[model samples]
Target chain A: MEVAGLILIVIGTFFDLFGTIGLLRLPDVYNRLQASTKCVTMGTCLILFGFAVYSGFSPAGIKALICMFFILITSPTAAHALAKGSYRAGVQLANQSVCDLYSDKQVLKISAVMNRDVITILPDASLRQAIDLLVEKGITGLPVVDSEGVLLGIITEKDIIEYKTYGNVETAKVRDAMNINVQTLPPSAPLKELVSIFSQEDFRRVPIVEDGRVVGIVSRKDIIKFLKEEKK
Target chain B: MIEFITGVLLLSIFLALYRIGMGPTPSDRAVAIDILGILVVGFCVIISLATGRDFYMNVAISWSLLAFIGTIAIAKYLEGKGFDE
Candidate 1:
């Protein structure tokens, strides 16, 4: 019995050694956590079990058993708590991480919220028609498209009003008044990227483009509404 | 024979200490501390057996309890939460 117990202790110590190596060598906190937790549990439990076998039914032996039992319950719990806490603390994963299942709720895709019923104007249309479209649809901007549905430019209420200030709003074509340089996004872009774009001065809406055609549009209100829905 | 077991346990404890000193993140340190605590319990039992004294088992049990509680407390701190939660 003494021999057997000693052998178990030897094995347990070996596991402990391997665990420490893993803790030292693993790339990130999360990987180290799994390695250390499993190895430590095996090492300590075996050592305690060895003590029980060597001592038999004495008070110390029974206490070793109880201590081993306590360890069994608590080791995994501690590991779980540590993993959760580390993630909540925003500890980033290693550079080569292949999968991340935890951050999905926080990072949303643009397709989840963008309006598909895109209101567009022809570039050759009068600026008055773009203004009417903006007011009739209660939208701030319109993507100006060619006959082939390829985006030419974007016209907003501000554009017409600015044209009225310096140019001829009534006579100006949508091509004349429209801002050709506008921000666009792919449907797969993350909400984080959208937030940065919307933060720019005088930026309110962005068009979602697919195949060089305007597929949808997203405004600040869409993001605000998405956030409000998420809260609920 | 008992001396060798005790030596191995001591080595494991040192490894844990090495991690505690070297770990970059607070969570790594906490894990190292936890492993250290568990190793100490085994160390206490082996010591008690070597010395033929039973009181070290009591110390072992108490150490395990303290280790579990301490690990949990550190985890809560890392979670950016109050201990009361």
Candidate 2:
């Protein structure tokens, strides 16, 4: 029995090793996570099972069993954390991504604070790409625009979550998927006004428009940062 | 044999620590540190078994709890909120 247990442990170790290698070698974050999570989890469980058998009814076996239970609880949680981290970090998926999971239709037509530039997205942009942009830019919202740079709708993280519940499917297009009506703020608005907006409204972000075009985007965080810098 | 395995685990812990320290983003660091904590728990379990100690089992349990609490706190902080949030 002990000999059989040792063999199981060895086999488990090999599986874990291969998983780690896959984690290191995978080209994209999503694929890496998929490989590592499945491999390491199953590998670790088998190893613990082996240890349990090898140690028999002694305290060692009990300890091994407890460890296995803990692993079972935490491994998938860890994978969830990693996947969210990758998404929040703006890690891009490879070529096959089709759906845009992070766009909001309500807040399209955004203005950038740094050069007063506008962020526009087409209907066909994948949800993954939109999410990647949000993560990369650290922005809370974006403007959904058509090929003519005409504002169609807006998308935000909240929209993404809502959409996920609306469809059991993963595929969605921005034009068919965005909120048509959007609220806007002009560049001439005062800082105090922006603060009032936050207090009075549920939105965390707003677009600053000038001359019928987006010039800058302002968020609650940006306002807080501005105040902090001013205090210094 | 135990010593050899222990040594290898330590090496992996160091490598994981490096990732935590050098990760470009907050999430990367958070994940690495969390994994390292799990690895530490694994080490404690192994040590308890090898040494035939009931005391080490208690220690392992305490360590696991502490690590869990720490991971939760850090994750909350990363999310821009505290326990209440």
Computed on alpha carbons, the lDDT of every model, listed in order, comes to: 0.85, 0.62
Best prediction by DockQ: 1
Best by TM-score: 1
For all the predictions, what are the DockQ values? 0.45, 0.11
- Local accuracy of candidate 1 as per-residue lDDT tens digits, A174-209: 999889888899998877678777885577899999
Tell me the fnat of candidate 2: 0.05
**RMSD each, Å:** 10.8, 17.0
| Model 1 chain A lowest lDDT segment of ten | A95-104
Candidate 1: residue A11 Cα off by (Å): 1.0
The local lDDT score (0 to 100) that residue A180 gets in candidate 1 is 85
Tens-place lDDT digits, model 2, residues B1-85: 5665556556556655665676555655665565566556556655764686656655655565566566656655654432233
Weakest 10 consecutive residues, lDDT, candidate 2 chain A? A105-114
Q: List, residue by residue over A109-201, the lDDT tens digit for candidate 2.
A: 222232355566776887767777878987767888767555556788877777778753256765545666676677654454566668888
lDDT of 2: 0.62
